[model samples]
Target: MKPDLPTDLTWPHTSINNNAHRVGFWILAHLTHDPAYMEKVREEIDAAYLTQGPSAEPDMGLLLCDCPQLDAIWHETMWLYNTASAIRKATRACAVGGKRVSVGDQVMATFRQFHLNRELFGGDAGAFRPARFLDDKSLARRKGYAPFGGGHTYCPGRLFAQREIYLFVAETLRRFYLELVGGAEGTMMPGVDRNTPSAAAMGPERDVEVVLSVQKL
Candidate 1:
């Protein structure tokens, strides 16, 4: 079960209030683009008994948000799409291994490098394969994939955000069908250069787009 938060601490007031939509969008984009993962997600959702009344068999509201499988999907998506570099300030002036180090030295950890590291992620880290997380050994190797930051400064809203994204994607797929319009493809994938702007305040730009048709399934 997911931890409960105070109602007063509701979103828009939370750390991720403003960025939730953007984050959720990226999560769905990755899922929709990867046929294998998408199929799995749909299959799981389909297994839940459907109902026409307010009370459904699976209580999809909870399944889409708090389910383990859905959360895993969100975690994988974040690991693959982390674009922001983590920054830390050094504490206490000191020398490390004879090298002089000063207090407050700005340190940047570009997680993107490690996230895409083939040595750590296997032969083809660039590939979007959620199955990598299904294996206990492989998932254990991803201990350093901290897209939500770490330590005392870690994001408290991480769990909430993941839940939100899961529900959003599930409901979207269950509802209307989405289709990429003509010419949308040309505008989909943008340059990924450092100079290129992100889809969000800190998201990386990628070159790819797929039109979708949203009809009832």
Candidate 2:
């Protein structure tokens, strides 16, 4: 007999697939923009694979835990590209940011504003610097860095989404070399499509053409 599925089953699938695609797109775009950074991430992935033993197969544990560069890239991508907003209702009367919040009042928090906040993220907050995350451990735990939401309503599929992006990036780079079709001088970085309504991650305004070749392993 077939098992029944819940009516909200599509929520997870939509959230994971849509947000992952957008996030992955930005990651690749940034990597293509900076070849040196790409090589750094590639080297990290290679080292992790080598440490996993002779088969050279990717170990989920290492991918999730061992590669600091990849982790930083992922975090930077989320910080720069995610446009998700968190909506919460005030359970009781309180003051936030000096604004009085009445009971049952709805408050919206925009991730983009927080992500781009110069005070919390430093002077280069608007820039896509993966090293920011690596250099500052406290940034991830800060109240302003809520890529997957927070509190009890935090995204349940966050781990799954992260794992999927990590595996995709690691495996793709492991077997292939990718570059923009026209090189950095000829091609410009795509702009964010802010005009579109995005529930999570936002996408590029234009498509970037890339050339992928099998690695000479």
Best by lDDT: 2
Residue 150 CA displacement from its true place in model 1, Å: 0.3
Candidate 2, pairs of clashing residues: none
Worst-scoring 10-residue span by lDDT in model 2 = 47-56
Assess every candidate by TM-score.
0.67, 0.89
Candidate 2, TM-score vs. the true structure?
0.89
Q: How does model 1 fare in lDDT?
A: 0.59
Tens-digit lDDT string for candidate 2 (74-128)? 9998888887788999999999999999999999999889999998888889888
Per-model root-mean-square deviation over C-alphas: 5.9, 2.6
Candidate 1 per-residue C-alpha lDDT over 1-217 given as tens digits, one digit per residue, 9 for 90 to 100: 9899677865336346445665666656666555566666766664553663333345566565445555566656667766646677779887655977689887766676777888877787766566677664356345567776666757777667656666677666665444333475543523334674432223435534555565444
When summed lDDT is taken over every stretch of 10 residues in candidate 1, the lowest stretch is 196-205
